[model samples]
Target: MTDFLDPVLTFIADNPSLAGLICFLAAMGEALFLIGLFVPTTVVLVGAGTLVGLGKLELMPLLIWTTLGATAGDAVSYWIGWKFKDTIKNIWPLYKYRSMIESGEEFFKRHGGKSVFIGRFVPGVKSVVPGIAGMVGMNFTRFSVVNVTSAVAWSIAHIAPGVIAGSALHAISQISVRLALVLGALLFIVFLSVMLGRWLILIILPLFPNAHAAIARWFSRRPDRISQWIGHNFDPAHPRSTGMLASTIILLVSMPAFFWLIGEVAPNEPMVRADLAILNLFDSLRTPLGDKIMVFMTTLGDGVVVTAVAVAVALYLFAKKAWRRGIGFVIAIAGTAIFVPLLKLMLHRSRPMELYTGADAYSFPSGHATLNAVLFGICAVLIAHERSRWAKAAIFSVTVTYVIAIGFSRIYLGAHWMSDVLAGLLFGTAIVSAFAFVFGPIHNEKIGRLTVAGIVCAVLAGFGGWHVHRSFDAALVTYAPQVHKEILQAADWRQTTWRSLPAQRIGLNGDAEEPLVIQYAGSLSDFAGLVEKDGWVRPPKWSLSTAGGFVEGETPPDSLPILPRSQNGRQPALVLIRNDPKTAKGGRWVLRLWPSRFEIMEGGTLEPLYVGSVVHEDILRPMGEFSGPKTDRDLPDADNNPARLVPGAVVRQRPGGTPVVLARRPEQPGLASQTGN
Candidate 1:
C-alpha cells in the first residue's frame, strides 16, 4: 500500500491531468455497493480533496464527476427499490434489510419526503432510504426534486474536501512527508473520532458500576483504620463484596483485551487527527456560523456536568425520583474524568506531530468515549425501560446516534487516538451494564451512599453550570507547535535508557519522525501512553512532548525558558513533571502546560514555557512526613520546584538533558538522613 501511493502522487505531480479521473474513480468506487464498504471511502475523499487544494486536481471537474457518480448511485438504488421492493424483502441480504425498509418507511411517514434528505446521513438508511422512498410510492416528481437537492448537498459534503485537501497537501509538501501526513491526518482524524468514539465508549461504560462496586468492596475489606472508619460511617451494607467480585472478573476478562487492542493499534496508525480534519470541515460547512460556531458544538453537552442535573431533568419531566439514575450519571462522568487520564498516563501516549500540537496528550479511554457511552448509554437504558417499543426504539436510536456524534467530536477536535476512543467505548459499555444491574434503581438506599452521591452530584452540576455561566474557556489556552526532528545518529547506541529494563533498540523520542517510532516496551503504561499522549498529559501521567532539536541561539540545556509563573486561562496546563521514584500515580496530581509566546526570528524565538506542575510528593506530605502542610511558597518559585523537578528539562528540548530528581524519602524515626543518601 505504501508502495502504491508514491508513484501515483508522483504521476499526479507531473501530469496534473489525471487527477480528476483518479478522484472520479475514487468517488465512484466509494459509492459502489459492497466495494465502498471495504475501502473507507472517506480517506480517499480527503486525499483527493487535498490533491485539489494542491492544484493537482481541478475543483469544478472533480466535484462534478464525484457528484455525478454519487447522484447516479442514489438513482440506481432508487430504481432497484422501485422495481424489486418485494423481491428484496425475501432475498438473502435484503431479507434482513426489511427492518431498514420498515424504518425508512416510518421515517418518511413521520417526516414525509424530507426523510430522504435526512436519512442519507443515518446508517441503516444511507443506501436504502432512496429505495424505501420508491417502495413507499412517493410521487416521481417530488422524489426527483428531493433527490437532486439532497444529492448535491451530500456530494458537496462528501467531495468538496478532496479538492481543498489536495491544495493543503500541496501547500505543505516541503514540510516532510511525515509531518504533512501527520497534520493532514490530524485534521481528518479529529473529524471522525467523536462519531466513532461512541462505539468504544459503549463497551467501557458498562464496567463503571463494576469499578464503583469494587471500590466500595475494597474500602470495606481493608483492615486499615481508614477502611474501618469509612465502613462504619458510610454504611456497612453497601454491596462491597458484589462490587469487588464483579470488578475482579472484569479486570481478568475485559481489561486485558482492552489494553491489548490499544497496544496493537492506537500508537501504530492513530487515525484521530485525520478524522478530526474531516469533522472540522463538516462543522464549518454545516454550522450556520461556520468555524465560529465550533464554540457551541464542542460545548453543546457541557451543560450536563453532573448526572444529577441530567437525571433531575429526566425524572422531573417524568414525575419520578430515582437515586440510581443520579449515581449512574454522576459516576459515569466522574469515572471518565478520573480514570481516562490515569489510563492515558499509564499509557503515556504521544500526540500526532514530531512537535506536539494543542490536543496531544495521553489519549487512551477518551473522555468523550467514556462519558458519551455513559451519556447515551443512560439514555438507552432509560429508553430500554419504556413501555412502548417505539419509545424504546426512538430513544435507542437517539442514544446510539448521540454516542457516535460525541465520539466524533473528540476525534474531530483532535482530542483522542482512534484506539483510545475504541477502548474507552468498550470498557464504558461494560461498566454501564454492570452498574445498571448492581445499582439500578432500588426502592431504598440501605446498602449504599446514594444520598451522598445525589448531593455530591448536584453540587458538582451546579459548579459546572457556574463555570459555564462565568465562561468555560476563560482559562483555555491553545498552542500549535511544529516540532522538527533529527535522527541524531540513527545508530547512536548509548542513548537514553529506562531504569525499568532491557531494550537494545527503539527508544522513545517524545514524539519523533513520521511513522513516528517508539519501541513497544510492552508495559501497559508505555504502550498506552505511546499512542494517546494527545489527551493524556496530567502529572503522575506522562506523555510525549517538547519535541524539537535545538536551533542556533536557543536556550542552553541548563536554563529554563521565560514563562508566566502564574497562569489564569486554564487551571490544568500541560506541564512537564519529572518523577524519579515514580510515586505520582493514581489521580492525585493536576498538570497543565502553559506555552510561551512564539518568536519567528531566532534569538527572538523564546523557548516554550510551562508552570504550576504539581507532583504528589510536592503537594502532600505522606503519612511518614508527620502529615502537615508545606510552610514554603508555591512554584515557579526557587524555594519549591527544585525539590522534585528541574525546570529546564521541562521548558524545552533537552532530550538527553532529561532532568529527573529522585523523590526524597521522609526521615525515619531511628535513622539519620545520610543513611539513605
Candidate 2:
C-alpha cells in the first residue's frame, strides 16, 4: 500500500521475466536447507502464485522457474550430504535440530530412497530428507530422479493453493457475490488439503502399518521406472533443461491462443470503453511536471530513437565481429516493427477519442510498446550472458523500468490504450525470446566497440529527445486551430441556443427568442475583465446553492450547471461564479469555461454563454473546466473550506489557511438610478 509498491506492481504487471525471476528466487530460498530455515518464503511464493492467477503473471514461466529452483536446491542439498556424510550431524545447526534430522534419517532408512519423494510433502522432513539420503550413500542418479519429481510436485502443491485462491477471487470479482461462496469453498479445500495430508500421513497411516508399508513398497518399485522415463524424455546437460522444455512448449501454445483472443476482442465496443476508462484516468493525473516527464519517457520508444539506437548498437556489434548478436538485434527490431503495424492494420481499431493531439493510426498493438520491448529487452538479453549476477539484476531491472515507462508513456500521453500496450509487450517479448534462444551464445568482447557504440547512442538519444519534444509540440498545435474553430462555432448563439433552445428547455411559448449564446471572441484575460465590469464576481466554490442562487433556486436544485471535464475520482470541482447581470439582478450564475468555450449557467439554462476562437492556449494548459464529459454535479470538497477571492485580482492563500468572502458587485457611478434598483 506504500507509494513504493505502485511502481513495483506496475513493473510486475508489465514484465513477465521479472515475475518468473522472483518466483525462482523465492522457491530456491524456500527449498535450500540452511537458507530455508531462515527464509519465510511461503508468503512470497504464494504471492507470486496469486499474481499468476490474477492474470498479472503468465502461469508457465512461474511454474518453470519455481520447479527449477526447487529442484536445484534439492540437488545442492543432496550433494552437501554426500560430501559431508555423518560429519554434518556435528554441525552446530544440525545439533540444534537433532530430533528433526534423526527423524529424517529414520524415515530414509525405513523408506530407502523413496523417502526423498515422500519427504517433500512433510514440511520439517522436506528440509532434511535430501541430506539424509546422501548421508546414507544413496546413488546420485536415484536421488536426482526423486528430487526432480518431488520438487515439481512440491512446487505445484504449495503454489497451487495460492493460485486457486487468486483465481477464485478474480472470478468472483468479475461475476457476482454468488461466486464468492465458490471462492470460500476453494480456500477451505486448500486448508483442508494441507492439514489433512499431514494428519493422514503422520497419524492415520501409522494406525494401519500394513497399508503404510504397501504404499512405501509401491513408491520403492517406481524409482527405476521414473529414472527410465526421465532418461528417455529429458536431457541432463542443463540444470534447467526440464523447465526450459516446459517453457518452450507453453510459449508455443500460449502465443496462438493470445493472438486469437486479441483478434476476438480488438473490434468490440466493450474494449473501447475499457480503453477510454484507463485513458481518462491517466488524463486526470496530467500535471505540468508529469506531462513533461511522460513526454520525455515517450521519446525512448519513438520510432526515430529506437531505430537510431538499434542501428548504432548493431553497428558496434558488427565492428566487434559479434555477427550473431548483431544479426539477432536487427531481426528483433525489424520483426517488431513489421508485425506490430501489421496487426494494427488487421485489427483496424481506431485510437480513443481522447487522443486528440495527432496520432491517427490504428490503436491496437502499439508501435511504441512493441519497439521498446524489442530495443530494451534485447539489450537485457544480450548483456545477461556476460554480466555478474548483481550486474545482471541491475541490467534487467533497468530494462524492465525503461520498457514499462515507455509503455506507460504511450497510455499516459493518449497514444495507445491499455490493451494495445499489453499486446505490444507480449509481441515484442516473444520476438526477443526467439532471438535470444537462436543466438544466445554470441559474445562481444570488444570493449572499444562498446565504448564507441555507447557514445554514438548517447548522442543519438539526445537528438531523439529533441525530435520528440518538437514533434509533440507540433502535434498539440496541429489540432489546436481546428479545435478552437469548433469551439467558436459551438459557442455562437447561431449554432447553439438559436437552434437548440427548445431542446435545452429554454422558452415555453412560440415567441421571438433572442440568441442568448455569445461568441466572446477575446483572450481569457479580456473575458475576465468583461465579467468583472458586468457586475460579476468569480466565487471559489462551484456548488448547486451558488448556481441555484444565480437563478433564484435552492441547494438541491431542479437543474444543475453542466461542467464538461474528465473526473478521475472524487476531486473537488473548481468553481467560478457571478450574480446575474440582467433580468434577475439578485440571481447568481455559474461560470464554467474550457479552452474552447465559456458558459454562464442560470438554473442550468444557457444564460448568454460565450465562445471564443481568437485565444490559443497550449494544449497542455490546465483549464479549470473538466477535460472530458460533463458530470451531473460539480460539487466542492467537503474537507476544504472555501477561500475568499480578492476583487480585481487573483486570490492568493497562505500555505494552509482559511479566509471566507462572499461575492458582491462593486458600485458604478449613478448605477442605482440607471438600473432603478
Candidate 3:
C-alpha cells in the first residue's frame, strides 16, 4: 500500500500542471446536464484538494480552472435550453428525461432567479436548473452573474473538506503514520458503504414489482399451509405487503448470521482470532485525536441518546394515532434492551479492554451497537414506509452509515470485539425485522412522517451532544494509551545495552531505511541548545501559510519546511536542519530525534534516551519552480560526525560499522527531571 501510494503522490507532485487540467475536466463534467449525473466530480475535486494540502498541487490555479469550467458548462447547458425551449420536451434523449426537466422547472418557478445559485448545491436540481432558467427566458446577464458566483462557491464547498481532511491526515502522520492510515481507511470505508447502499437500492428498486409478481405466482401454484399463510399476508393487494415481505427476507438472513456469530464468539473460534488481530491493530494505531473522535461517535449510541430518541419517536407515533407503529417501536426497543444483557450474561465473555466494571465489563453482543441498530433501523422503516423510491434509498443509506459508524467505533475504542459488534447488529436487525413483519402497513394514520423524523433527529442531537460534552474528558483518560517504562543504568546503556536498541530507522511499511546514527541521553532543551550553536535551527511547522512556499518561486533551502518522516509508526520528537554549502543550488542536513523506550537513570534523574537519524535533503524543482524538499538517500560521511557538534559525546561503532553518537547532559546537584520516552 505504501509503495503504491508513494508513487502516485510523487507523480502528482512532479506534474503540477496536470492537477489543474484534471480539476477543470471534473468540474465541467459535473456541471453538464446529463453527464453531471454520472460524473464523480465530488470525489475528483476533493482528491485534488487533498493533493493541494499535501503540497503536491497549487491551490490557486486549480481553483481558477474549476470555476471557469463550471461556468462554461452551465453556459453551454443554458444555450441548449434557450435554443430548444419547449421543444426540448420532444427532443429524443431530453424527451425521455422530461420528468427531470419538469422537476427543474418547478424548482425554478418556486425559487425564481435564486434557483440558479441555490440549485448549484442541490444534487438533482443542480443538473437542470440552468437549463430551466434559460427555457423560461431569464436574462443572460443575470444568469451569467449568478452562474459565476455560484460556481466559485461550489468549487470552494467541494474542495475545502478535502483540504481539511488532508491537512489533518498529514498532521496525524507526523505523529504516527499507521494511525493516519487507519483514519483514512475508516473515512473511505464509510463513504464507500453509503454509496454502495444507494447504488444497490437504485439497481434493485425497479425490479421489486417483478419479484413480487413472481413470488405471488409461486405461492398460488403451491396450496400448502405455509404458502397459503404467506400468500394471504404478503398479497400484492395488501397495503403493508411490501413491508412484511422485506422484513421476512431480513429475518431469513439475519437470524442465521446472528446464531452463527454466537457459535463463533462463545468458543473463541477462528473469528475470535480475527477479533484479536483487529483489536491489536487498533491498539497500535491509537492516537489522542482518534480517541476523541471515536468517543464522540460511541456516545451517539449511548443508552441515554438511544432511549431519548426511542421515547420521542414513540410519542410522535402515538400522538398521531398510529397505535400499531407505536406499539411495534416499543416492542423492538424493549426486545433489544432485554436480549443484549441476557445474551452477554449467557456468554459471559470479557471485553478487549475493561472500560467498565460489573455487567458492563462483559462483552458478547455490544449493547451500544444493538440498541442503535434497532433505533435507527425502525426509524428508517417507518419514515420510508410510504415515500418514493429515492426517498427510501436516501433514508436507508443514512441509516446504514450511522449504524456502521457506531459499530466500528466500538471496535476502534476497544469497548467491544469485532464479533461482539457483529452479533449485536445481526440480532438487532432480526428484532426490528420481526417487529416490522408483525405491525407494519398501517392505514388511515394521521402521522406526518417528516415531522416524526425531525423530532427524532432533534432529540438525538440535543441529548447526544450534552452527554458527550459531559463525559468526554473522563473518556479520554480511560482510553489513553498504556505505556510501560524500562529503566537502565547510564553506564550500562553507554557500554552494552545501547546495542539492544534498533540500529536502523524503520519506514512506514516496516522496511529498514536510514541508520540510527545518534543516541542522546539528556533533556531536549539542552540538546537543542547544543545543536543551535552548531548552526542547526528548527524549521517551521507545516501549515497553510508555510505550504505557500511550495508554489512560490525559488524558496531558500533553509526556509523550506522539512517534511516529517516516521520510523516504526512514530514521528520524531525534535527536528533540526542546517544548510549544506556543498551544494550550489542549496541542500540541507536534516536531523530527526525520536524518544526511545529506554530511560537512563543518571544522577538520580531518569533522563530520556533519544534515537535519531541525520540525512541530507536537496531542493526539488518541478516546472522550473521550487516545489518542496526531497530526501537524498545517500548519507554524507561528515554529516554524521557528532564530536564537532556535541562536546564530550562518545563515538561508538555498531557491528555494521556505522558510527553512533551518545551524548548526555551534565549532572546537577539536588535536581531531578523526568520526561516521556
TM-score of each: 0.40, 0.41, 0.58
| Model 2: per-residue Cα lDDT over 101-198, one tens digit each | 78888888888888989987866677788888778788989788888898888888878877887786667546543233323333443444344434
On TM-score, the stronger of 1 and 3 is: 3
Provide backbone clash counts, one per model.
108, 8, 0
lDDT of 3 by residue, 313-413 (tens): 99888888888788888988987788778877788999867777666779989999899988998888888777876787788778888898889888888
Q: Which stretches of candidate 3 lie over 4 Å from their true place?
A: 1-14, 28-38, 50-56, 67-157, 160-187, 207-273, 308-321, 346-348, 356-359, 383-405, 433-440, 448-474, 483-677
TM-score of 1: 0.40
Candidate 1 regions off by >4 Å? 1-19, 22-47, 50-56, 82-85, 104-123, 129-150, 160-187, 190-256, 259-320, 330-426, 433-677
**Candidate topping lDDT:** 3
Residue-wise C-alpha lDDT for candidate 1, range 225-305, written one tens digit per residue: 998655443332553433334334554655567767665644333343333333233322222122122333334444355
- lDDT head-to-head 1 vs 3, winner: 3
